[model samples]
Target: MGTAQAATLAASLSRIVADPNDMVSLSDVLRQRQLIARMIEASQGEAPLQQVLNGAVHTAAQGCPAPMAKILEIDRTDDTLVLKSQCGMPAGAIGRTAGKAVEGNPAGEALKNAEPVIDIDVRRRPPESLPDILKDNNVVTSVSLPLINHDGPYGILEVDFPEPTQIGAFHISFLAVVAGVLADNIEKIHARAALIVERDAKAVLLREQQHRIRNNFQLIIAMVQRSVLQTTDDGCRKNLRDIERRVFAMASLYDHLLGLSVQAERADLGRYLSAMAASFDDFYALRTSGIALKIELQFGIDVDLDTCTTVGTIVNELVANSVEHAFGGSEGQITVSMTREADDLCAVTISDNGHGLPAAALESTGLRTVRLMLNGIGGRLDVQTAPERGVKWSILFSDTPPRKRGAAKP
Candidate 1:
């Protein structure tokens, strides 16, 4: 053959070797002799994996002139060949089995030897040796090809004729090639499915680890709270209480991260703030000294874990500062609001209806800690204060793009 003709023949054979679906057009007997040399040169290429094996069987059957064609997968659990796909076969024959023994039936025989088994005249064979499905369908001649991959035998492909007819060696060889391609594609698809299953298993394991870590933090916070209750010195007790609240804030952040449906790289800012506010309210409620305190929280954005942690610390410091210094041994109210201003910007306002901060209060260690926390999240803090009027702290920061409005609520 000319170089150009040889190349075209090689490409066609490669397509046939890679995909059983391409075999329907490859069974032309007149072209077989001329293409045999090119077929030998065709390299095995990767076939696109299919979700279902029945489609491969149906495609292969379309090329044959036989009266019936079917594919049966080996059921290793029971050592039976269960029919998976079929064309021109009885409805009840689709899922029928070829029994437990591999000696009698053509499908079982082909799978046992990893080769083709041809019965040209089934009537001449012993009646017990014939498959019930085939005998009932009046099949006279049948050819079964084992579908074998690198992993060994998996299934069998069978074609049946109503009348006894001679099948050439070339035709049987072509069918074997089709079976090999189909088996290869099935193996690749099975491998991919196994990988996905393994990945999901690992994700479950990681989530369990995160849950344990959150539980450990809760235990630590409980121990700290017990320490606070045991202290006799008023100053020491107050310091220990502050330590417990800080640890609680860290614990709450972890709880939110673990509860998220997606990866825990970010958190719902509104939800986290609300949770922190609730924790503080519960802690301070027990120290009732006729100080009626009301805390209002409104949130409208989400932030990454780093930003969430920094903002959470800032809130912890600022809110605690307000509770200790804003109310001068009297009843007061604190309102915390978070709103998304734009795609990448958000503002948080924490205000109180109590005695406002003096100029010296801004220079305190608590306010300095809040400033440092804001800086870490690439945020700016602004304080509006006046004596006896009250104090409002406004913090504006860059945030992730806003989620759909009704998607998450605080």
Candidate 2:
């Protein structure tokens, strides 16, 4: 502003004091910009609609001075202005209906005509009964700004000035802008609320489907275990154990899905082994008599689906061999660890602190299959064992494209 106008504004503002109850043009604590800023900041997120409305009413009164403000929601059904939120009004005036659409009601006229309605002087204006808002506060002039936008009419914003001359073109223009901002914010809150409900519904449906899938996995496991126990032949029993292990590992993938909102492409190797190994113990629970093998798995990296299947097969085959043959029914421990060999290559070591593999058991079926799976993944196996000592199998593979490997000499 120019020096002359700045002086004029400063002189006009000098009359007002620091009062939260009154918002005039500009006071030490109250100003138009601050009031509008506070009003615009009153979003309808998480907060109840009534609380948001009340906050906006108080903020609207904040100017370099604020006005005594009230918002009367338009009830279309009853054709009345219901007092919803107010600032600087007597407590009793809240929730009172400002009668219905009538001849002389400024607020009612603003809503009805969808335009601005002004009362030059509420003190001298002739109405049989003054609305509680006007009567209870020192309102000399009042402007009823209809809160409307492209959507529809929301309510009426009643801005009350203590002095009649305070109603200027600037004040009316500012109120009009703030009213639109409030209406837009209300509509946004409604849209977000609807979306939140829809998202919650989808989560419920997903959990239900996951529960059914888990049930199916348990049923399959039960059938495999029954077959393993019923068979007397060692070969048949071993084959059943293999099938049970595969199913157990597959179920681990399902369990992983239960914890997520979306499906994951990469699975944690350590988590999969923990679940599969636990299920493996349950499968042998009835047959094994003496010491159980305690399996401890360390940190594992994320791997794609194919790598998971390959690793799952190799790890289970090794674990099954230890459970069936190692310690010969005596107590022992199996330690599984995965570590980065280099930037692109990784290795998993499964070791059992038990009587080492029998000398006669070189190139067994389990070891042979381990070689085959390693070849498929461009991996190499280094087996360490000694009589009366434990066996450690370290399988190394690259996370990048699998390199070609020659078939092993049996």
Candidate 3:
């Protein structure tokens, strides 16, 4: 590969806990890599930001071979640098506001250039902040590496030496890699905090929105019920009653939702449908006398809100079909079941053991509604009916998106 291509590859590899830049010897590079690998394995994943900062500072002190190492966080609120972690110095000095982190000093120069700035023999050029500590400890050289990434500057990592010395390529590389790792972790911590705040805010708004939605649904049901009572036309009354039942089916879903699902609006499918089924039984208790409504629903099956509503509508329609038309004003049994047939398949079956239905009943408005709702949710229905035999309707749909579609991992 060309030099540009090789450099690009090396830069990408450096992000994986290893930096191959400015290596003076094979041993130096290997030691740097090994120390970084250990540091990452110890501090990765959900570690507190303070703990991570301490780990990075200690690792820098060890690998850079500095007598003292301290990390300062950029306090943008006051345009100051605050000591976060320190090793081989007074531990009580932590949390002290160290310096004005502007573009005048060696530390500020590193932050401004997004690189390392080295100053040796500090007797000639002493730093403004932390002067007493450096003088008492006879510190001579100070190397400052900016803790920065694509999100911009976070802080600075400073490694100071007691004796006058020229820091080598390996030490600078090690400090740079440590600063990069620390900066990345800092970014992740900030992003996670932001998301938590956003989620909490959304949850509050979501609860209020849900309450308003529930109230609206109840108002619609009540209005439909009032219309049912006022209308004298039998056909118009039946249609209005159907509307009331449909609205009730949607409203009653909130009752069976037990706990939180993977998604905010998701719920246990079987429990949700079972609750709706119980409500339906109660709604048609007079017509349902002497008839057994058996529900066999599978728990833990989850789907989105749209799928839940659409499938619930389809299930409600099919169950209503068997409850009203399958029996000739007599008594029988109705079985409603939902099951998971495969990793990505779901089936809902509603069957009834009653006198057979005429072909004209299958072509009624209820079946049309069932078909339409099923189509809306990417599902299909199959029916089996004959004279003296019962009626069975199975609705099948995939629980997962098609392979050709893009999907994110849960």
The reply for model 1, stretches above 4 Å from the true place, is 1-51, 65-67, 92-94, 117-124, 164-185, 196-200, 232-239, 262-264, 286-300, 363-376, 401-410
lDDT of each residue in 108-171, candidate 2, tens digit only: 7777766677777877756564665566567778877776644445577777877874555556
Any idea what lDDT model 2 has? 0.68
lDDT of 3 by residue, 1-410 (tens): 32322322233234333345634778767877888888787667788888887888788988877778888877878867778888888748787765566654666666666556778876775455444545665777888877764545657888988887877665766776777676667777777889989988887776666667767888998899889889999999978877877887777765443234313655667877888887766777834477788889998887766678777877776677677677877888889899998887799898988777788887777777677766666777788888878888888876654342233221
What is the Cα-based lDDT of residue 147 in candidate 3? 71
Model 1 lDDT tens row, 205-300: 888987888798788878878888788889898787678768777888877777786345667798898887777766666247334445545555
Model 3 spans with C-alpha error above 4 angstroms: 1-23, 33-55, 86-141, 148-154, 162-165, 168-170, 188-196, 254-267, 285-292, 303-306, 322-333, 341-345, 353-356, 375-378, 384-390, 402-410
Off by over 4 Å in 2: 1-55, 72-85, 90-105, 122-134, 137-140, 149-151, 162-166, 226-243, 250-280, 286-291, 295-318, 325-331, 336-349, 354-388, 393-410
RMSD in Å for all candidates: 8.4, 9.6, 6.9
Number of the top-ranking candidate, with lDDT as the measure: 3
Ranked by lDDT from best down, the candidates are 3, 1, 2
Shift of residue 285 alpha carbon in model 3, Å:
4.2
> Cα lDDT of model 1 overall?
0.69
> Each model's TM-score?
0.72, 0.63, 0.72
